[model samples]
Target: MASATFRATDAEIANPERGMYVWAADDLAAWTQAQADAQFAAGYRIVYTPVRLDRYAGEALPRKQLDALNESFATARRAGLKLIPRFIYNYPGGETGYQAAQDAPLERVLGHIGQLTPVLKENADVIAYLQAGFVGAWGEWHTSSNNLTLPAARTRIRDALLAALPADRFLQLRYPPYLMAWALQAPRWRDGSGASRIGVHNDCFLASSTDVGTYSEDAATRRRERDYVAALSAVAPFGGETCNPADAVDPTPRGDCDDILREGRQFGLTYLNDTYYRKLFHTRWEAQGCLADVKRLMGYRFELKALRHSPAVAAGQSGDLTLTLRNSGWARAFNPRGVHMLLKHRFTGAVVRITVASIDPRSWLPGTTSESSARFAVPAGTLTGAYDVLLALPDGAGSLAGDVRYSVRPANADDAVRAQGWDGMLGAFRTGTTLNVL
Candidate 1:
């Protein structure tokens, strides 16, 4: 049992693989057979979210995608697993004929929710939410959304949803700063209407348009998820960073579990999954294909409340720089389970020196995010090339992420040069350094 009085329900744990990346399937049988074989070999259950009809098929609620997805659901159930049929809406392409009818009454939205719920109810696992700013999220690779302009329509749709969804059904609003603000002032529904489970999911790990790429947790994405959770939580109870699964990535994975776990707990989110579209293929060797890396990121976000650390550095120095760390995660090291934060350096190809910390593989659960510090001394003879600090966390009673770098040549850090390095040939392989766990 979770320590919290308001822990997540059984539905949230539909399947607990820690991370998920998906493959497309014109035929569900083919995907199921392939995935089953892979899962057995991986020694882990794989979380596969089928492509919603809103994507590739052009059917906002296309029967075919649903049918194909149902097949996958059937397979998952048989294998003792779960499948979330992702439904992305409000995108220009997803603008169904029915949307125009929503209007102030939101009748169209209600009818649509009403229409789809029944089709999915029998497959209770099909229970899920919507992508509020669906097509507009750069995180989703369909970033042309600013041009697509989902706009304020999400509120209306959300209103209709209040009356349509069941008590436990959830809907994730993609990066809606505006909605977050509005949600703060208003509840998900007017009260007597039905309870709507709402939250935020971001493509923090995603990097490209139709590309399965991602970036490490920076201040902005953190701010967004934090803000969204802050806002959405006012109306609902949970939220999370919908990260992508990664195998190989630059800057490596780091300090994210702090944010991930922080937001999960703070926002009432006990369960987390990737954006339905934020994924790379197992065969994909691109920097975006960080499934292995993303694995280190599952289930760590608790509830981050603006706890930030500032480094005391000036020039290129070998001194230990300490930044203020916070307990934004769900659990503390003192708990039955402990969460630990690690820092590492991307030293050479296929090699990363686990400089400051290591992965504590033994503890971690689906709803634990602990707070800790990241301290590392610049190597005595470190040169002036480029370097990064990584943070690794995971899902457990304690923490489940691994070593993540936090800084490089701290004292000499430059705004312009660092800016150049920012979004640079990112998604590329950095030097290989391995951090042996403690």
Candidate 2:
């Protein structure tokens, strides 16, 4: 994991340069489209979709929802985001708003579980984690007269939900104040291992004494919140932090979007998600502010080792290869668009050939990353033993392609998981010891 050393004070994620998730609206198309803009922006790289949970429970989720998830994922990928599902515990309508905290029925609210069970099982690839420490004003506040309060009872139910979730995933804790005084102790989790992945989600922007738009811009307010999160790193380890007012509204702002990120660095925050408000959802230009933030932070230095490919025993009509694509360097590589490397074959002469499909890498991690790969068959036959493999942009940009050292042989039965195809563009087949087919 990139964030293995991320202690209480570090940004608790593996790769913060691009580990950005956005809390989007309920509308699938709009959310996906908005994420594209967020991707173009510098900061928001990972996208948490469908802000409204009602549609997820009552509508799009009930259908074979994979296609919508695909479209949203595709949108995020195109916009350069690693897609993540932001699970909500309760839907908006039907006794959601204005209800007394004590009077609300836990089971009825918890009933959303049955609805989310299948969704999580099916879409865990893009799913980030369930959103907690939230309520009416959209799960962003703490200790207000707001909608959801982090009572022990509700948090226990949340722990149950996480128990039912799959492997290598995490939980994003939105409001950390209540978390420290009341939330974290509700559940116990030993983290970063396959059986015990646990984490937190925090942000510096919040409600204000002035206008909501003016919240983070306040001189005294931004500093206090920044220090508050920095302080939390000492106790509550935040895996992610989503800072808003990602905008630059001048007026002598002490720490703007850039500052929120620097805090993530100081506090050992691993994953960083961005929240886009309702008013600015429609504009592409508004998103560039986010894009710049991401680029600035992604400048971490890493030591890189080339991937080693398999030797060709025989060249048949079809086959595949798996290489030890090691991160020789200490740093990790994260995809801004989520699809980073493209494989290409150099033919005898100047004629170059490329893989029919692109390579979809696993979770953006650091140090000797294991790369699983697959390719198809050759129609006829050719001079086979050892062939050259080149790495570069997906489109073969001469200006962008990296070194050529990796090679591929054949794929084994243990490879290929239908579930793996759910996230990025995952469909490149490797035949047997021979050439590749479809």
Candidate 3:
């Protein structure tokens, strides 16, 4: 029989690697900091920035622009936030559509990615994912003056960007057909193991039957694309925004929250734009009192079902710890995060962390439970006292490893734990269960 030490019920609170995103460029310093801080305070951890390359379609991004972009990344890092970055050549013209005047040549777009590779690589830690955005207005890859949709140009651009990014970072395409075509040509994409590291994003999600052309107009093609997106999201990140309610042509659904939940689970969505058409969401769902559910289920909400271990241990001793966790959110964590068990002094607050190398939290899919066990080594010390065992999910990267801003909190309704701020991190929850070290 196992001796359980800690148990918890699921609760709603903001975690990391998922949430509503702030839409703006990182280089917009004044707007970036204010938005990032406000969003962070409100329990959001992701920001979507469209890095406009429209101004210099014919030339390299100016030095000033590059510096500004780097500064924006630094700001996000400081604020302990992640950004979903897209590089676009043109903004959508409200009525005219497809303003080709500012569109960059295919070659220029590829060159720009190569030039920006250094910055992207340097700050890859803060990027949630890169949306392939060099073509088309609003970077949706349609109605473009440039013929980037042509197979050859598209392939070359995709290859260049893929080569520029590190293997870990994911890139998102606008359409599923585009990726399906590419997959047919490359066996890696067909492997369905996320080797291609590419996924799709639906900007005008759930607007119309065709979702504003996110999928094919034909019924069969739409089904195929939907399946493709579902398959891709099993291992890759997939998400987007709800389109403006006023523009939705579909009358039957009428922003049904149930439909949203159904499709969200079906598609394995990892994130969404919270601000766009948000008023409609508030008006429709808030009064009905289901918006809180939507917020909790958006990305990955992990709960600790049970934790068991030896109730007592000698100083410098090694012992076994086991944890059973359930993922209640809509999707899995699409990025890497560290899982460690912390042994903290009750009085002095000194801590010793044992990282579990065998457990990868990214594989914790929704509606599923998983068990993990690992041996923890307690440090040799002179003082013998009771210790608080805490669980920490911090960024694996060394720079952010010590920053509690990057640590993830569990969705348990323990106000004492929530208020106690885990390990020196202010406003950060470090989940705990008690243990004694003699």
- In candidate 3, which residue ranges exceed 4 Å CA deviation? 1-11, 25-30, 99-101, 184-196, 245-254, 279-282, 312-317, 380-384, 415-432, 436-438
Clashes (candidate 2): 52
TM-score of each: 0.41, 0.48, 0.89
Best by lDDT: 3
Give lDDT tens digits, candidate 3, residues 1-438. 124333344456667668666675432434467767877887778888878777788898888888988999998887778888888776765635555435678878888988899988888888888888888777777766778879998888888777777777788888888888867532333243334588778886776677766778788988888887877777677888877634444423336677677788877778888876665553576777777777788788887777777777787887787878888888888777888877677898877676777777876778899898877766677257766667788876777777888877776555463332344453233445566877
Q: How many backbone clashes does candidate 1 have?
A: 60
In the order shown, the candidates' Cα RMSDs to the true structure are 18.5, 12.4, 3.3
lDDT of 1 by residue, 34-134 (tens): 67545534533334343432333222455664576566666654453333344433223342433331111234334445656555555544233433322
Model-by-model lDDT, in order?
Answer: 0.35, 0.38, 0.74
Question: Model 1 off-target regions past 4 Å?
Answer: 1-30, 40-66, 88-115, 126-152, 159-164, 185-196, 205-438
Taking all chains together, the TM-score of candidate 3 against the true structure is: 0.89
Task: Please tell me which predicted candidate would have the highest TM-score against the true structure.
Answer: 3
User: Can you give the lDDT of residue 90 in candidate 3?
Assistant: 67
Sort by TM-score, best first. Answer: 3, 2, 1
Better of 2 and 3 by lDDT: 3
